[model samples]
Target chain A: MAGQPPKVDVPILKDLTIDNITENVHRINSQGSDPRLKYILERLVTHLHDFARETRLSTDEWMAGIEFLTAVGKKCTDVRQEFILLSDTLGLSLLVDSIDHPKPPSSTEGTVLGPYHTHDAHDLDLGSAISGDPSGTPLLCLCTVKATSGAPIADAKVDIWETDSKGSYDVQYSDYSGEPDGRAVIKSDKEGVFWFKAIVPVPYSIPFDGPVGKMLKVLGRHSWRPSHMHFMFEKGGFDRLITTLFLRGDPYETSDAVFGVKDSLVIELGTVSAEQAKKYGVEEGTKLLTHDFVLVTDEETRKLRDEEALKAMRKLGREGMTIINGQLVPDVD
Target chain B: MAGQPPKVDVPILKDLTIDNITENVHRINSQGSDPRLKYILERLVTHLHDFARETRLSTDEWMAGIEFLTAVGKKCTDVRQEFILLSDTLGLSLLVDSIDHPKPPSSTEGTVLGPYHTHDAHDLDLGSAISGDPSGTPLLCLCTVKATSGAPIADAKVDIWETDSKGSYDVQYSDYSGEPDGRAVIKSDKEGVFWFKAIVPVPYSIPFDGPVGKMLKVLGRHSWRPSHMHFMFEKGGFDRLITTLFLRGDPYETSDAVFGVKDSLVIELGTVSAEQAKKYGVEEGTKLLTHDFVLVTDEETRKLRDEEALKAMRKLGREGMTIINGQLVPDVD
Candidate 1:
């Protein structure tokens, strides 16, 4: 080969395209990448690559994907996280929550970790309700508790919050009533039951002012979550569950913007007789949802006792830490 | 339990600070938030958690970290990727390069895959040098290719590129003069040698204008890479090699800003004797560097040929294709 012409070095840029998703997956997987970041990246890369291949994605389209995600990150703030919403919309929220907390055989199944479970709910009277506005249909929320095996459990703590009569959570308004005031923690009474009064929830769209909303527009999809109430119940000896219950008949129930609603979670408000409704002080046609939550009893939990007042609670063998504008008291049962 | 005090329902929020690095590592090795994302996320989480613990990081500090990363993503542009630079500074670039193109026994070792290797390099004539400036030092580069058995292998293609006297790649400055023109392909002569004249290499820093620069400032680090020339070589019936040759005494020899410098890749550029300089038609004091590159030759590659190119050469098939700007060409090769 001494006198032969120099070998041709033909460019193969096409090989770098996403036409071969499996090969690209193998390339990333077989390559020496960060072991810790590998699985997530591999799955992400594979899914993304497969998506590109599926769509016959062009360079500009891939670039747009990057741009959309960047905008989502930019849209996140102290109270709002568009990236989280993007995750919620992509069903990643439910997937991540399911992976973190597997279902217990008898306890209510946990659902998507909604974006608003930021602060600890305050303990309230047995009949207190979070929504205070008077613009929507009235609803009586009956809360009951039982062991997985049907044994009654009294004094179970129930923290509940829902949208107002106008279908707006307290946090959604420009003027918040109180940071944690709308939220409440109630104790079941002597009958292993607690009850609160609130307006029936109306389905509403998630805030569409951010990049996530922009993405929804680009994908030609709606950004509304079904009407729902956030619930964080922490009883003695059970895994703390963070979940939500959607209004069964909401329009978005089937396509719950966040993929959060489950069949087991849909509760029907059995109608009470007009005479019985008058006895409790509500109209007969008014919606009243009765839900008896069952807690799994086998799980062990460590509780922190709260004092009578915030100041007393602060001094209960704990050092109070200030974060931003809020005080974080360590929960010691 | 029924008569428990109202204050007793709260659970103690312990410090709950994860302090043990080993335990964190174990946790990552055990479970990630999502099984699908676990393997990769575990490692990433491990590294991130370890980094946080190692820094004795504060909550605000951690939040700042998140914010910083968010900013990086937001700052990325269509042509610029700040996250890649972040990864470069963190030694992730070399890690990726190492895993992607593991070196063969006889080929020169590869180095960092800079963010700018966007397209295949262009080929140039043997006597042509990419240097266009008239004032920089005039130095000659000579390459000798030999098989692992010490036999010369003629007709090999050598791709080359280096920063100009001002220390900037073309893409970085977009001034063309600072770019690598005719830097991609150089063919070996009958003696298994290729040579060209240009200015001696100089140490340079990566661009520090964007979020990457900001990150370097926050971390209190510099951004200098050792002087080096990037190279990629291939021939018929042999493995393609991508590598670099570092200037032995560059300022960042030990502390390469991106941690890309390797011992085996360093080469000395000895001063040429006046007589030898004259023989090469260069002024006195001109430098001459000689690098002997050995390639690995195996039977499997010997029989291999570019199907289209070979067909074109034999006048038996459709001619090969060419691309101008990310599109197929009908006439040019």
Candidate 2:
């Protein structure tokens, strides 16, 4: 009795029925100070309650969902994130990524930032080897960064990471001594070009011993991602791009478990001649992977995203809903 | 390449657009062997994706949701279930309870079984005291159990638990030495009567130090349940009942944080005369509370539930969906 009760001025919620429960929940949550949070909570409750009502969800099923979520949370560690994996397998990660990072037709598209990225990648110079002790096929990566206006963008920071010959990241090993291997961070030169020496990435299964993996199995889905190299580009005055380059010949190219592959992001590995390989200071018959990334300026990206949002709003013209300052709100008028 | 790929014959998911992502996900998940699981998952994915798409959920917002769920999951332990608390505060618990345990009009309505109930309650005699300490107001309880068909249901197992005067269950204490206090498991006598002495149940806050508590605060809501005693009844040939009895005058009776209160479950406590208190072997001026529970037979409950399910299915008459063996499935015709 001494503690303060809820400060919300709404009438006390009582005798809730299935038909009115969603509205009552929205009323209670409307008291939040942040309009965006309130809006998101309202939509979340609507969809969640609708799901329950439509399915006639049983008590046992609800308990199973709770237990499954608990297991996923328990499976997450400093190095592993099962929740993100859940989002990825459910195709939500890609959907969010696509919505938040709309780009022009000429600009490079973005994808999901998988859970394996770390901040401790060794900073290496251009043309340096990313693999510490390579056992895979030698690969020579040649990349160029440019703006959509055909202007070379120099000094762009590029972070690269990938799995090794045995289809395992450095962090996935038991004896991982906190050293960065098969990954590096480098910047483009004045000519807007950066090349790195690395082994060809190998197709690998996600950590399939966890709850997300169990869910994929139950869904009759695989956990294998296509052989790919992760890349993140950061520069001032431009929208950041987080993407992956999938090898064209990989068996999982079309069935990437994370739904991260895009048509433009897939490229075939060309077999370089012995002379060309030697000229690049690599083995006699190295595989060459080449790509040119076109970035859109931040200002242009904002405009494009606003257009997309407006289109979506028009498509979802539900009664009583309106967009104000790009946020969905109840139309008071 | 040595491991078997997904056995399901669905085509590889490719170029998933906002308009087609839902269909692709469903197509992939349709390969699941269990029809029930497949149906549940299809609905879950549909609602989940719709929630995101309708909100145009940003990447940052998605990450925040993932983190929030992770925190909620990590907050659970052997004795505490934060997910259930989340479900309760969201009103899903009561919805599922109402759907799965439909009963006749005369039968007592069931509510949520709050997270505090424990199976370790001491099995006391029919009229023994359930409290361990003498710190709170003494009260006497008399209860009767009968079938809706007007027959007494003797020897029914009655599990009762409540918070003490300090608004804390015995298990909430750090020094809980595996002893039962303010809780008991008793059987009704031959006349379907049970009575016990206990301290007046106190209004209490749910565990608010976890993610669920933080969520409530953000929503401008309190976490208090009304002063109530939890009761679970089980008898042969009858449907099990999990419900709580609220004191009528409690301020939070109508605004129970978990939405567990119902009109039929509220009762008023009466002051007993000095002679009456002495007759019950209690101190003078003790409070007396009484209730008679009407339970439905298992067969009758099944019939009611089937009717409810049929009504719900009719209400959700979605095209291309049909009920087969009481399960929702896609109609081929």
Candidate with top lDDT is: 2
Cα lDDT tens digits, model 1, B35-93, are: 32233333333443433322223333334544665777776654466666665565444
**CAPRI quality of model 1:** incorrect
Q: What is the lDDT of residue A102 in candidate 1?
A: 42
Comparing to the true complex, what docking class would candidate 2 get?
medium
Per model, how many backbone clashes are there?
Answer: 19, 0
Listed in order, each prediction's TM-score against the native is: 0.50, 0.95
Model 1: lDDT of residue A100: 32
Per-residue lDDT of A1-333 in model 1, one digit per residue for the tens?
A: 111111222111112211332343334233233332333333334443333322222233334544665676667666666656765665445544443344555667667665565565677776666555667777877777777678777777777776665555667777775566346778888777887777777777776777766644543356666687777676677655666776767666655656677767877666756985876676787688887777654332111111122333254333432222122222222
Task: Estimate, for each residue in B94-123, the C-alpha lDDT of model 2 and write its tens digit.
Answer: 888888788678989899987888889989
What DockQ does each candidate score versus the true complex, computed on alpha carbons?
0.05, 0.61
| Per-residue lDDT of candidate 2, residues A127-234 (tens digit) | 999996647888899899999998999999999999889888888898899998999999999878989988888889988988888888877778888899999999
